[model samples]
Target: MNIRQYLDSTYLKRAIQAGITEKENIKIVQGFVREAIDEQFKLVMVRPEMVAMAKKMITDAKSQVDIGTVIDFPEGRSTVEIKLDEAFKAIQDGADDLDFVCNYEAFRNGQVDLVKEEILKCTLLGLKHHKVVKWIIEVAALNNQQIIQLSALIKNVVMTNFKEENYATVFVKSSTGFYKTENNLPNGATVPAIIMMLENASPLPIKAAGGVRTYEEAVEMIQLGVKRIGTSGAKAIADGAVSNSDY
Candidate 1:
């Protein structure tokens, strides 16, 4: 099967996060962009600062690899206004897909209205510009019930506020690939988590991000009905090897 098109090849680490110099980090991003161009992955997911660089590289190569960036990143604690500002900038910088980390903390605190408001506003901003939007619910940080509720919440917001034709463009994604769990637990997508999202976030697509490591795992996600898989090990998975990427 051609799994490449369903993959969002990713590299979201910063210099400090990756334990490298700033110049070295940039060099890695550059190579990542080029690899996406050559490999023709559906999109290249990067930090906001690298969106324009990825865009330029893909444009120069005349490749079809789309550019994606995260807003509010691993922490979904940022206010809606700040998330909007970050997303707006990413869009202007030529990102074709915007994955905003959902304010899962607020949801956990029972601030449903706040969560709904941000989902609606941020989603509208993305759809208005014809960009694909994915809400990262950070499954690692949420319980099973929270995952179902948040996924359904995002689906409700998209369904209630947007046109039917636009539903597919907005996804309820699984994780941010950056959440830390206690005691070396899996910090990303798991079967139960993806299933909860799939069942709850139906009409809106599902993008299983984080912790997916092998071709078999990717295929299993696909068979279980994930529309996309976001992983730093896109190449390794595509080549049928076990990926060593922490993300």
Candidate 2:
């Protein structure tokens, strides 16, 4: 399989998180953009503030790699207005795709309507701006039933509110790659979780982010119908090298 095109080639860690200076962190993101250009992967996923820089860098390099950003990242507890504002900024900053951390806690708290509304508004924002919209359900934070329910919610909202031709423009992604767990377990995408998402979120594409460290794991997800794979070690994966990216 030509796996490069399916890779998002991600680097979402911040300077403070890595104990580096902010300037150094951005340089790393810049390097990621350069790598994405050289590898011809799908895109480079970064924090919102870096979208414009990545855009300019890709433009100057004469590369076709798109730029994507996260919204309500790691945690989905942000209010809808705040999320939308962040998304608008990212859109203006030249983000080609937007991955939103859905209000998972709200849904789990029996606030299903609020969760559905958040999905509807965010999806509409991305579609109207001509960008792909992906929702990170953070599967590790929920039980199996919650995963199934949330996936169904995304698929239902999209089908009911969006045009049939645009269904593929949105995705039900697996994780944010940054969720903290109590048991020190795997906190990102897993095989069973991806399978659950694929089975539940049908027509909507799946972007399996987090913990997809190797080419074989990524290829397995793709063969199972995952439309996108988000990882920081894309170069190694494409070259058949192994590296356990901390995502």
Candidate 3:
């Protein structure tokens, strides 16, 4: 399969997250962007501050690689206004996609309305700007029932608020790749969790993030109906090997 088109070549680590100097981190993210351009990958998913850089790089290279950024990344605790502001700035900086972390903790705490409000507002921002919006559900942090319910909740919100022709602009993504788990389990999208997302959030698109680091694994995700695979391993996947990228 043409896996490159399905990969959002990702590098979301900050200087502290990867234990590198800020300069070094910028260089690494730049390298990732150039690689995405070279490989004709679908998108470059980076930290919000780097959206402009990705835009400039793709523009200078005369490439069509889309730029994407995360909102309330790794953790979904930001207020709705804060998330919207972040999304707006990224959009202004030429980002074509935005993935906002849904308040899974709020949902688990029975604050269902809070979760809905957060999703609704952030989604409206993306829709208004005509950017692709994906809700990161952080499946690793929830039980099976919660995953199913939350998936349904996101789908319901998208269907209720968006036009039928614009459903492609909305996505129910699997994880943030940073949520801590008991027993230190993988925090990204797993096969079972992805299957659950596909079954429960149908009609909405799926983007499987985290732990997808090889061509074979990415193929598996696409076969399971994921429209996008977010990974730091796009080059490795293009090379047909296991990626050592931690993000």
RMSD to true structure for each model, in Å: 0.6, 0.8, 1.0
Q: What is the C-alpha lDDT of each candidate?
A: 0.94, 0.92, 0.91
Measured with C-alpha atoms, the lDDT of residue 127 in candidate 1 is 93
For candidate 1, the clash count comes to 0
Candidate 1 lDDT by residue in tens digits, 1-247: 8899999999999999999999999999998888888888999999999998888899999999999999998898999999999999999999999999999999999999999999999999999999999999999999999999999999999889999999999999989988889998988999999999999998999999989999999999999999999999999999999999988
Best first by TM-score, ranked: 1, 2, 3
Which pairs, if any, clash in model 1? Answer: none
**Candidate 2 overall lDDT versus native:** 0.92
Candidate topping lDDT: 1
TM-score of 3: 0.97
lDDT per residue, candidate 2, 1-247, as tens digits?
7799999989999899989999999999999999999999998999998999999999999999999999998788999999999999999999999999998889899999999899999999999999999999999989999999999999999999999999999999999888888878988899999999999999999999888888788889999999999898899988888957877
Off by over 4 Å in 3: none
Top TM-score model: 1
C-alpha lDDT (0 to 100) for residue 239 of candidate 2: 83
1 versus 2: better TM-score goes to? 1
What's the TM-score of each model vs. the native? 0.99, 0.98, 0.97
Total clashes for model 2: 0
